[model samples]
Target: MPPLLAPASRSPWASLPEDLVRLVSWRLLAGDLTDYVRLRAVCTNWRSATMSPCGRGVIDPRFHPRRWMMFAEGHGLYPGHERLCEHTRFLNLDSGFFVRVRLPLFKDHCVLDSVEGLLLLQRDEDTAIRLHHPFTGDIVELPPLASHNLHMSHPYANLPQLRPISASVSIDAGVVRVMVIFIHLMYAAVATSQDTKWTYLMHWRLPSHYGPLSFRGEQYLVHETMNIENTYLSQIFQLEAHSQDPPKLIVTFPREKLCYPVYLVECDTEILVVGHNDISLTHLAVYKLADVVLDRFIPVKSIGDKAIFVGGRNLCVSSKALPTIVGDTIVYRHPREQHFMQYCLNTSSWSLATDECSTM
Candidate 1:
C-alpha cells in the first residue's frame, strides 16, 4: 500500500479562523490600549477581523487602568487653532504609557477634575462648568456659574476669581449626578437631570477644601475645615437622594497633626487624609479614618503594596496592578516646581520620579 500522505502542516496561530482571531482580540480588552493596538497591528487579516476597543458606551470593567489623567499643554495661537495641536496626553499609570488624546473640547476649557473617565471642565471665557468625556467626545452642559445663588454680595465673594474648589460626577442607569463646590460659597450645589436649577446644600462653616465623594451607593462630600484655634477637622456629609434638604453631617474628626494644604481621598472603601509639613521634605503623614464617628485619625505607616498618585486629583492602585509603579509610596506634583516626586512610606524618604512621563 502507498504510504499515507502526511497531514498538511499548519501554523498554530496562523491557522486560527477569523472568528477565533476576533475572540482572542476581545480578550485584550482587559489590557492597556497599547496592547490592544499592537494586537491589531499583528497582521492585516487580524486587523480586519477586530474593531477598535474604544467605542461608544461604558468601557469594559476588565480594563486594567479604569482612569487616566489627561494633562493639558498650553493652548496654541489663533482661534480654534489649538484643536489640531496634540497637546493632551493621557497618563495611564497601569501601562506607564503617555498616549496622546485629541479632543477639541479641551482646547478652550480648563480641566478641573477627572473622575470615572469623565472630565469636569470650566470654560475660560465664562468659567462655566460642564462634564465631558474625552475619549467619546460627549459633553453635558451644566448650569452656568451665574445661575447659582452664590451670594455674590458677600464681601469675600471674588466673582472674577470664582471657580470650583472640587467637583465629582456619578452616572447610573442613564442618569447623571454632579456636585460642585465654589471657592467662596458656603454651600455645595447638586444638579441632576430631573432638576432645572442647582439644589444648594448649606453647611455650618465654609470648608477650606472640599470634594465630592461617593461611598456605598450614596453621595457624600468630604470637607476640610480649620477652627479659630488652628485645629484642623475633617468632616463627612451625607447627601440624600431625591431630597432638596441639605446634606447631613454624619462624621467629624480632628486632624490636628496634619498641616495646611491637606487633601482627602477615598481608597478601598476607606477615607484617607494626606498631609504634609511645608518645612519637612523627608516624610508626609497619612491618616486613615478608622471610625467615622468615634475614632480619631489613625496613623498609617504604610498602605501595603499600593501607591497613591495625587495631582489634579487623587488615584490609588495596587502595585501588583502595575508592576512599573512603586508600592507603599505617594506620588504627587510639587505645586511650586511643577515636578513629580515620590514619597516612600517605608523609609519616609522623598525622591524625584526619573520616568519622563511622570511629570505629565
Candidate 2:
C-alpha cells in the first residue's frame, strides 16, 4: 500500500500579492457597488488593495465600460427580460441589462438631451431647463426660458413645441456654465453663476441641425449651413468663458462636399463632423478636422473603434465599451418614427433596432 500523503492545505486568499488583488478589484469597479463591496469582503488583502476606489473605479481604456441606450421618457425592453418601469431605462446591448432609474425631478419635465450621464430637462409648465445626473442625483437649474424674450409679437402658447433644440454644460474651476440654443428664435443663451441674467446671442442661426461640443476647456457651437451658391459649409463658433461677447466664428468647412443635417462629435480628443446626403439619406460622410484654425476637414472612411449615437442629442463611445455595439456605426432615432435605426460604416447599410415602445 502507498504511504499516506498529508492532506494538501488550501492557500489563503489573503496570501495573494497586493498588486494582483488590486488588478482583480479594478475589473469589479465597473460593476454594481454591491459587487465591489462583496469583492473587498473576500479577504483582508483585497479590502486594503481596493479601499481607494472612490465612487467608481477608473475606466480601463483597453476594456471600456458598456454603453447603454438611455430612454428619456419611457422604459426600454431587453431581448429576454420583462418590461421595465417608466422614467428612464438604460439598456445594455451586450449584457442585456435593462435598468430603470427613478427621477422624481423629471416627473413632468421633457428630456431634451443626455450627455456624460447628465440629462437636460425642460419643464412642461414653463420650459424651465435643468441638468440632472441619474447616478449621482445632482441637479443644477438653468435660467428659465421665460426669462429670455422670444421676440414674438403675440403671446406664444404651446411653448413646449418651441423647446431648445440643443443644450450643453461645462464646468471649470468649480464654476458651471450652460449653453442653450433655441432654433426657431435663432438665439443662443449662456448663463454662469457670476452673471445676474442669461446672456443671449442673436442672429446665430444655422440652416440645419446643430449641437454644442466642449473640448480642451473651451465651449464650441457647431452647425452646418448652405452658401448662396448652394454649397454646404460646416461652421464652428467659440464661446468665450463668462463673457457677454457674441460667439466668434473660429472655423468653417473649406469644401462644398458635405450636405445638410451635420453633427459634431468629439472622439479621442479630436473633433469629427458627420453629414448625411440630403438626396438619398442613405450615405453618410465623415470628416476629421486636421486643423481647426485652417478649417480643414479630411474625409475618413472609418471612425476607428467608435460608435456614434446621434438624435435629439449626440454621443460618441468606443465599440469595446459594449460588446454587441459594432464599431464604425451610427445609431439614431427617426424624428417622425418611434423606432431606432442603425447605419453601418463598413457596409453602408441601414437596419432598424428593436422598438421598446411598440410592445406597450
Candidate 3:
C-alpha cells in the first residue's frame, strides 16, 4: 500500500465556477457602490447584470462611506456654452452646482426625499409626477391616478383597477435603473428572520403607459404608506388633489391617529421608522394615504431611531450626534466625519462649508 500522505490542500476559492465569479464581481460593483461607481461605466455586461434582482445583490460589507455631495463649480471659460448649462442651474439643496431640468413648472411644491441617484420632488399633490435624472437631465412624466379618467364622463366606474404606485432606484455597476412598483405593501421584507429571506410583497406588472391597458405612472416619492381605513388625517392633507374622481390612497406610514410628527428619513433600507421619542411622550402621526390605524405602527418614540448602514466590514450610521441646544442632534457621521458633525439633510446639512453646523 502507498504510504499515507497529507491530503492536498483545497483552495478556498477554487470551487467557485467562472459564471459565479462573474456574477459576484458584478454584484460587488453594484452592491458595493461606495467605490464601484467608476467601474459601472466600464462595460455593458457589468451594467446589465447589476441593474436587476437576478444578478444584483444587497449592500456589500465592503461598501459605503460614500461621500457624495452636490458639486457647484465648473470650468470658467465656457460659462455660456449650451453644453455647459448642466452645471449652471441650482438644485433645491445646494450640492455646489446648478441643476436645470426641462419639465413643466410646478408650484407650491416640496422636494420630499431621494434614493440612489434620484430626487423625489412633489407638487400638486402626487397627481402630477415627474421622474428626472439629476446628471443626465432625463425626465419621465408619471400618469395621474385612475380617477383622472372621469374627465370624459362622471361614470367613474369605468376607471380601471387602481393599484398603489411608487418608485425605487438602485445603482448596479454604473447603471442606474429607476424602478416602478405597484404593490400592496409600502415596504417589503422577509416575514420572518430565520427562513429564506425574500421580499414578502408581490410585484404586480400593470401594462406600461404605452399599451391599451396603460394606467401606469412613476414618481420619486419614498415612505409611501396608506391606511385602507376611513379616517381623515391632517397637515399631509394639504397635498391632496381635487377632482371628480378621488386619488387612490397609497400606504405611506401605516397609521392615522398619529398625534405627533412622524419623522421620516431615507436610510439605506426600508423599515417601518418608529421612534422612541426620547423627548416627547406622544407618537407623531403622519398620513398613510388617508386612513388612521395606530395599531399598524412599530412602537417607538421620536420616529425611526436606528439607521443601519455600513462601510466595508464596519456597520454604522452615516452620521453622528452631538449635544445641542435642543437635544442630541446627529453630529458628523462616518464617511462624512471630516465635516457636518451637527447638521442633517434639508437643514443646516449644507448651509455652508464652514458655518457652524449647529444651525442651518
Candidate 4:
C-alpha cells in the first residue's frame, strides 16, 4: 500500500538538454534571427543555453535581420489601437509572416534608411545618427553630420538643413564600415567602427548617385549624370571600404529610357537593376548582368521563385520559403500611394498588395 502523491511539476521546454537547445537555437538563428530570439525568451534555462544576439554584437552576421522589412503603417490611432501600435511590424519577404517588436529607437529617432534590416536612425533632438538592428536591439553610434566641417549654408536655418540621401553598411570579421551619400555634398562620407570622425571621400565626380549598394562585401553605386548630347548616362562605381581613395568606375552606358528612380539590388548570385518605366510607378523593367567583363545588363522576364521588395534598399527573397507570396514579382510602394503594390513580371500586371499583405 502506498499513499497518493501529487506529481512533480516540470516544464518540458526547461528540461530540454543544453546541447540540444544550442543546436536548435543555432539552426533557427541561421534562418530567422527573430525566431531564435523568441526561443531564448521561452525559459531561463533556454536563454542561458542559447547564444545571445546581443552578446555577439550587431556586427556578427548571425544577428543580421535577413529577408525582413519594416512595414509602413500610417493610420489614425485610437485607444484600442494603442497595443497594436506599440509594436513595430516587420514583414518577412520570404515567408510572408508578420513579426511584431517593440523598438524604443523609433520613439525618438527617424529612420533615414534601411539595409539588410539595419536601420539608419537619426535622433530627433539633435539629429544624431546611429545604426540600429531592431530585432536584436543593438546600436552603434555615429557622429552627427553637422559635427563635421561643411561650409554649405542656406537662409533657412530653422528647417532641416541636411539629410542623408543613401547609406550602406558592410560588416566583416566584426569590423563595421559605413558609407553615406548626402544630397548636396560633393563628397561622400566613409567611417569605420574604429574611427571617431567621418572620412570624406572627395574624389567623386558625379553629383547624383543612386546607391552604394553592397554586393558580396563590395559597395557599388549607380552614378547618373546628363551628357552634353541631352541624354542621360549611368555609370557603375565600386566604392572601396576603409579607404579615402576615389570610387572605381565599373562601367558606363547611356540610358535609353528616362528611368528617373533606379535601384541596384543584390540577388542571390547576381546583381539586379530595377527601375520604374515612368513616374506613374505602373511599369517596371528588371535587368540582370549579361556580360561580366563588359558589365552589360539584359532585360529579364522572370527571376524564378525570387521576389524583390523595393525600397531605399531593395531586397531579394526566395518565394519557395512561403508559397503565399507570388514568385517573380516586385513589391513596392508608390510615392503618392498610401498602401503597397506588386508588379508581376510574369504577367506584366499591377495589383494592390493591401488585399494580400495587410500592414499593421
Candidate 5:
C-alpha cells in the first residue's frame, strides 16, 4: 500500500468514527483520568474492533489515543507473564456501562498506555504492547528500557538508603520519554554513604527491543525535587520533554501535607491537574509549567464528601460532615488575593480554562 489519506474536502475529524471523536474529545476535556474506565464502556463500536486497530493512519488510531489506563495483574510491582492486564474494559459516561477486555501479561504490575490501537505496557523495568481485537486474543511485546540505573530503584542492601521513588513518561518528538524523580526520604540506617538527600529526576529511552516494542521517544527526565520546608508536602512534578538541557519540571500541590494522589492532565494547550482522594486537596488550581507565579489554589468552601472523580471537565469535591468535626483547612480560590472564602460546599463554583491556567 502506498499511503492512505482522508480526502482534503473532509475534515480529518469529520471522517473519524464517532468513537474516535468521543475518545479524543474526552481526553481534551478530562485532564489526568483516574482511569479511562468510564470512557471505554459506551457501545460495541467503542469496544469491539476487528483487524489490527483498523484505521487509515499508519498507527492504530484506536490504541494510540491520548489518555488510557491499564491494570497491573498482581500484588507486586511491575508487569510480566505473572502480571497480566489489558485495556479491554472501558467506562462510558454517555451510557452507564463498563466494557471488559480479558488479557494476560498485566500480571505483576502492568503500567498501560493506549496508542495507535495498541495497548503499551511497562512492567517494572521492561516494556511490552498488545493490540485490541475482540474475536482473537492477540498481543505483541515491545522492547525494554534503554539502560537501567540500579540507583534508580536502589534496594536496601544495594545502596546506603533509598529514600523515595517517582516516575513520569511523556511522548515527545515521536519517542516515549521516561523519567524517575527520586527523593531522599530517610538517612542510612546502616553504614554511612555520601548519599545526597536530593531528588534525582532521571530519564531514559524506551528502546524496547525485547518484545513488540516500537516506541520512539523513550527518554528519562533528570531534575531535582523541590521541597518548601524539611517536611515533604503533598506535591509532585510534571515533566516537559521539549525543553533545553533536561526537560522542564512542573511541581504541583494537591494537599498541603498529605501525599495524596495527584493527576496531571495534558489538555490541547493547558495542563489540567486534579488533586483528589486526600481530603486536604479540597482545593483545585491550574498553572503553566513555565510560570511559577500563576500557580495558586482556587478559593472555595470545602465539602465533606470524599471527592471520588464523578466525570467530565467538571469535578465535585465532597466529604462527610460530622457534627463533632470542625473545619481545619480553608479553600481560597485566590489565596494571594485579599479576599478569602472559607470553603463551604454550597457556595463554591469554578472551573479552569483549558487554553490558560486562569479562573473560569
Candidate 6:
C-alpha cells in the first residue's frame, strides 16, 4: 500500500531481452575483442548475458587472435640508459588506436612469442619457461631448459642468454613445444611439453635461421642451403617431435638469388615465402606455394582484402573484419626503427605509419 503511490521505473537497457543482448554481443565479439570487453563492462546484466573473452582461456578457438601489438615506453634519465615503464601500451593494427592497460606480467618476464592470444614468457635469470594469458592471469608451466646433462655437455654454457626462437601451445591436447637457439653452442634445442628436459638437434652443415612454419596441419622447418654455385635455395624439412629420427627433407625450392633472409608464412590456408631486403625492407617479393610435391611457387600479385604481419610469428588477417585497416598490405617494424612501416602490395610502394609510434 505504501508503494502504491508510484511504481518504480526500470531502465530500458536493464530490461532488454537476454536473447537480443546476446545477439548484439556476438556481433561486437566477431568484429573486435575490445568492443566485446566494453560491452561486458557496461552493467551487471550485460555482463551476465555476454560470454567472457577469457572464459575459456586464451587457447579457446572462439576468441579472436590479438590484432594489437604491445609496446614499452622508455623512461629514466637518458636515451642510452633509459628504463622501460611497467605500464603496457597496445596499438591496434586496424585503426592505429592506442590503449593503455595495466599488466603486471611484464614486470619480470620476457616475451618469446605471441601466438593465438597467448604469450610465451621467460623470467630473467630463470630457466623455467611459462605460458601467460596477459588479461586473465592464467599460467601454464613448461619444462625448464637447464639440466645436469646440459652443463656436462657444454662446460661454458650461459643459461641467461636463452633466446627462444618459437613456441607453440595446444591446451586441449596438453602439448607445448619451444624451439630455442644456443648462440654460444651453435646448435638448436627443442623442449617438448611431455619431456622434463630439452633435446638437442645439431645441423652442422645447414643452420636454421628462423623457426618452424606450420602449413597444412604439419610442422615444417625451412633452412637456407647454399650450393657450390653460390646460389641459395630454401629447403623444407618435416619436423618430428620427441623422435630420435632426423628431420626428413621434403622439398627444395629452385635455386634463386636471395635477399636478407627468406621467411615462410602461412596465409589464408596457403603457405607463402617472403623475401625482403635487410634495410627497412626496401624491396619485397611474395610467392605462394602452388604445388608442394612439385616444389613450385606462383608469384602472388594481391592478397585480396587481407593484411599480413611479419615478425617473430607471421600472421594473416582479413582487413574486411577491421574496416579501418587497409587491405593488401604488409605491416612490419624494422629492428632499427621504433615505428611501424606499411608496404602496399597493390601499389608497390612503402609508407611510414607516422601516427603509430612505438618501440617494438
Instruction: Please tell me which predicted candidate would have the highest lDDT against the true structure.
Output: 4
Q: TM per model?
A: 0.61, 0.62, 0.33, 0.71, 0.37, 0.65
lDDT of each: 0.61, 0.60, 0.31, 0.70, 0.33, 0.61
In model 6, the runs with Cα more than 4 Å from the true position are: 1-31, 59-61, 74-85, 147-152, 155-157, 173-207, 211-220, 226-231, 238-250, 256-260, 266-271, 276-284, 289-296, 304-344, 347-360
Ranking by TM-score: 4, 6, 2, 1, 5, 3
TM-score for candidate 6, residues paired by index: 0.65
Encode model 5's per-residue lDDT on 1-360: one tens digit a residue. 956655653344344576665656456334422233234343344444212222312222223333333333344534334333443454322222344565554553343434322343445433222233221343432333222333345543442123122323333233333333222432111100111222233443221111111122222221223367653344332233223233323343434422333333332333333333345454443333334326654432333342323122222222232232223222333323323333333443433212233332
Query: Residue 220 of model 4: what lDDT?
Result: 74
lDDT, model 3, position 209: 20
Which residue ranges in model 2 land beyond 4 Å of their true spot?
Answer: 1-69, 72-87, 91-99, 123-129, 149-158, 193-197, 202-232, 240-242, 254-256, 276-283, 290-296, 309-312, 317-325, 331-344, 347-360
Q: How do the residues 271-337 of candidate 2 rate in per-residue lDDT, one tens digit apiece?
A: 7777774545667777775454565555677877778887655677666655666778887764434
RMSD of 3: 15.4
For candidate 4, the 10 contiguous residues with the lowest summed lDDT are 151-160
Higher-ranked by TM-score: 2 or 6: 6
Sorted by lDDT, highest first, which candidate order results? 4, 6, 1, 2, 5, 3
For candidate 4, write residues 160-253 as lDDT tens digits.
5456556767777777887776655545677776776776665454345765576544567777777898766666777655555677777665
lDDT by residue for model 1 over 1-360, one digit each (tens)? 977755443335554689988777777755544566688887776788877545432223232234455544455433234454734666665545566666676567776655555677778777676766565455667766665655344443455445645555555565667766555555566776445566666534444344455433345566767678877665667654444456677766555455545556666658776767443444578877545345565568888877887655577776765566789989887565468888898998888865676345
lDDT of 3 by residue, 118-181 (tens): 4444454544434444443444444433323333232435222223334443333433333333
RMSD of 5: 14.6
- Provide the global lDDT of candidate 5 against the true structure: 0.33
Evaluated against the true structure, the overall lDDT of model 6 is 0.61
Question: What CA RMSD would candidate 2 show?
Answer: 7.3
Write down the lDDT that model 4 would get. 0.70
